[model samples]
Target: MSDIDPGQARPPRRVRVDLPGRAYDILIGAGLVDAAGSILAERLPDARLAIVTDETVAALHLDRLTASLDAAGIAHAVVTVPPGETSKSFRQLEHVVDAILAGRFERGDAVLAFGGGVVGDLAGFAAAIVRRGMRFVQMPTTLLAQVDSSVGGKTGINSPRGKNLVGAFHQPDLVLADTSVLDTLVPREFAAGYAEVVKYGLIDRPEFFDWLEWKRAPIFAGGPERAEAIAASCEAKAAVVIADEREAGERALLNLGHTFGHAIEAAVAFDPARLVHGEAVSIGMAQAHRFSARLGLCPGQDATRVEAHLKAAGLPTRLSEVPGAAIAREVLMAGIAQDKKVKRGRLTFILTRGIGRSFIAADVDAAQIDEFLAEELAG
Candidate 1:
């Protein structure tokens, strides 16, 4: 329940997201999952919980979590869905919600999302819609979830139109990011996860981006550097969310690469075989830099540097690099048009003037995007 672990290179760090009347803490470090039951028992005494995880995660880590709950005298039931983006759909959401209801869990009971982004989104959305907004907890077990998805509580299921087209703004009551769990990930997954960390730097914390450029190796090696990066990303997001909880203004900055990323996802039909969220975001971020260069808003060297870093990390930096993702100009345009960022038939893009100077370019010309996609597709 405390933020100390002498065995760790650095003591666990905590970031608070202060929402109006509903503040929550994001705990990032090596042992949060193992300590979750004690943490929860202290935070929400006698509250029942339904643990929602994906099959892959449940197989790998659920037993330890259940053991923790038992040690703390807490009651919990586990519900697991398939691992992947497909699980973040209405069908899976219904299954999760029904499982919770059938388990006789009440509104006061928390739905603990104990996996990566898919489980977090699906389970969080379930918790949001069930019992007219039940309490939810985030026990993120992956690098991607630990840094980005787990903190903000932007939970949702996907729609036929696009990725995250259907979702709700439901903040979590608590977030436990267990960095040790990330050690289980293969290099590709870890690299993909690192993309989100870069995103925070690319957002407004330009200094953080500069830090990552030098410290990426240690960050990936996992220790104090990993903890520091996660804590910083959470702090950065908490500031934006506290200022604009609903993405009505500055929070839109958080979607720096999402517009283009989601378009790529929509075109690929959200296939993990082709690309995952972070990989799409990697390509999208590089594309954003390149697109800005094309628009004469940024220097080409900046775009090249971004692409070089992503490529070195094994992330796709160009549209051509995304496996099995050859999106046509019209299809790309259509997907962008249907993106969540599009408001009233106008498009919003996060373009950069330099590596860390990203700004919202509202009502960007659709023809320009089309022309860019045409060139992007050609390459």
Candidate 2:
């Protein structure tokens, strides 16, 4: 926030997640995907890579990545899954792992996650499990993955019981976040991804939040502003991951809306047609602010500000905005109970002291949550 002036356009940026042993660079730009071979070559020369992506992203961007790799003399194999949250399943994870094994890729090879969050999580998890572990690289094509999922090492498959319930702490070797790829995303997909970008602002970066409030136009328009937003987000997340790579402490603060968002994602059964990750996070973050207000922890105006920003971004800010058939309160609560944040059968949440003042809240009362959720479901 201090270094970059929002009024003046800047350029594409890079941010590093400086973990002790798993440190990696996040290269944010427009045409970096076209440089995928060069990028990986610098890190892992003579690498046999397993490029994991989904059908949708494969259709649009795979050729560019493959050509780039081919030009750089990087040998790789492709494994494409159906594009959706549904791909984050034990079944799909096994398939990806088998595909990688069926090919010439080895444990030393990097498993390249070449799509959105689903591909990132599934591929990264497969990378983690295959032959004990393997190097991973994130080539996030969606806004959600570039700013959030693509950098962090949180990889996993979803359970029928809950979302992201099973995974590992396998970090990526490098992240090539090509901002240009966002151009191919439709409005709704882009908007859903923007929800995660907004999250960094809300998470202990008040000035950044203020910056987002004003720069929505250029940020969405895609330019230096867009790159700045992504860089700033990566910076915020990197700082947190550095402090707590395994969600033991400050890292949990990153789940500002995830506790509620994950529930929404699960209840809708991870259906992209009905809901996407960031859209659910929008509703979840709004719910968090409102829930905080109910607990006298956040001002109503602050909640309003959070809701307003999400709504203006074309993100749904309420549970009712979910597109599918009505999901029952029992189903929603069951999902919450199964959230990975739960500790020893007690629920945990990332509640806000105020905007940019989020903190981990352990053992939040079940009755209060139940009562509050009853109202959310009624709408």
Candidate 3:
């Protein structure tokens, strides 16, 4: 929990993910990209680097990062991919792995993920398999990556079967979250990321959720609240990763909205313009709460409060809000069936008793879900 004062200048924050033999630090601050050369030079003195980024981010921030590396005399090579969810495919993964091999980077060297979630997942997965396992670093540039994906070690590309089905649990050696870079994001992108920020609160931090409600405007305005939000999110995610790095237990709680969200994403074939990850999550979370209430597992008002807050933050919170053709019930249900959380042909979902009271419900009834989604679609 961060106690940053709104009126004071905030210092950089560090959240450590302390695994038994694989501990790493998440450094959150402004201008970290400009300082990356010295940072890498000090920590990984002898390791050459492979910088993997997307074109959009390459255009926006790659030169500054390269210059920083050059100044520190750290040897490096760059690999660029197209920007967007489509890049997280087997084809692109092969392309990146080949590029890394072309650089002749060794197992002891590092691969730096230099964009949003797509680049981080693609690059980290490449690092996991390259030379049997290279060191990985996350330099997340988007609000979503900075707060969630970059910290958790859940790296993977989407399968045609599902989102994030083909990947690995390769944690990064370090995560450099440059809040300054978020200034380059479009408003819609920022709002999408904010959905993940709102997630930490809904997943067991009612006090934090309360704080977000009070400070939403300041956070959106890029005040001290923004850094505090990022810091708090990293801290929240780090705590979960430390407890269950492989997502074998409590870690599943972090996917509070992902089961339904991934389904919606798969339904659209992961089109960003139709629906991005965070927006799908916003809708999924709202649906999760509404379903919880319908099942008498949570108070209806709690679900209402969650939806209202997310809507106020400029996020879409309903299936109807999703653009394009109506996502058929069968498509969404099939996506849910393919979710990684399913085990032994049984379903598992993170349901809530109220705000900050999420619990994993294994063996959830599929028929009930079908009925609930039907009502959701009709409304």
Candidate 4:
């Protein structure tokens, strides 16, 4: 249902990947996986590749990817992981390593993460550890991975302590995004992914958010505008990653909604039955907007507008609606404390001053956060 009109011709959107020496391109278009062999061959050269994917994506598109690699004369092995955040574990990663060893993958061989964010994170982490670091390619199928996780190269597994607690900065050698796979996403998953697409607009691109406001329905329904939106979002993310590859500075800005989002995820143990990543981000962003308004960064109207837009996009926008709102503030703070941005035992929060303007605040008072949580929990 993508909007590519056979009548109109447009060059594929290309974003210069982040790492300087590791610079690559993010190829976005339809039927790209079918054309992936040439792309991978050029980027990877003679590296033997391991295709790490999920059961769902493997069933649908693994053959096409394998066929493409075969035609390119690239030796490859397919490794499938269970499709979920739960699969991002030490045990699962160990299993992948075993598969790599059993398949005789060499030290120079690369791992191809061929699914959504989970596959990207899990496989990227495995690539980082396999023989103490091998190359990896990100083939993100979901919009969330393409827009946020894949471009950044922050690969990790979740811990009971917090999400992404154990990870590394392993940039991919290349990223091939065949937007066509989105066609197979169920309505709920598609809507969940949109939450991440909308975050870039709220965090740094107010104009983009306005553009999205006008195009949400067409995007949801699948049109050319949808493809354009995906390309634009990835471009924005890629530029940010290039400027701050390791997330030591401007990269933290990308976590605008994720701090709250990750906590929501922790509160739910990352069960899709309860919540998905984008849905948590949606609710998190709405709450952060309210907190920002209360801190006098923006008017309350901004929070209302954010809430309206997320709800319209089929995302949850309330904390109380979550099952654990009644839980102690300390529990949520504990999760916030585990954030990678923490320094000297103090939490550094990314707060928005207005749409498209955000700043880091290590001096933000805990009293203010408690007050915000009280209201968020009650209301």
User: Which residue ranges in model 2 land beyond 4 Å of their true spot?
Assistant: 1-12, 374-379
TM-scores, one per candidate: 0.93, 0.90, 0.93, 0.91
Q: Scored by CA lDDT, what does every candidate get?
A: 0.85, 0.86, 0.90, 0.81
What range of 10 consecutive residues in model 3 has the weakest lDDT sum? 1-10
Whose lDDT is greatest here? Answer: 3
Tens-place lDDT per residue, model 4, 82-115, is 8887898988989998998888887788999999
Q: Model 4, which residues run further than 4 Å from truth?
A: 1-11, 323-330
Clashes of each: 0, 1, 0, 2
Better of 2 and 3 by TM-score: 3
Overall local distance difference test of candidate 3: 0.90
Better of 2 and 4 by TM-score: 4
In terms of TM-score, how similar is model 2 to the real structure? 0.90
* Clash pairs (backbone) in predicted model 2: 204-356
The per-residue C-alpha lDDT of model 2 at residue 160 equals: 80
Per-residue lDDT of candidate 2, residues 276-316 (tens digit): 78899999999999999999999989999999999999999
lDDT of 3 by residue, 92-185 (tens): 9999999999999999999999999999999999999998899999999999999988777888898875567798889899989888788899
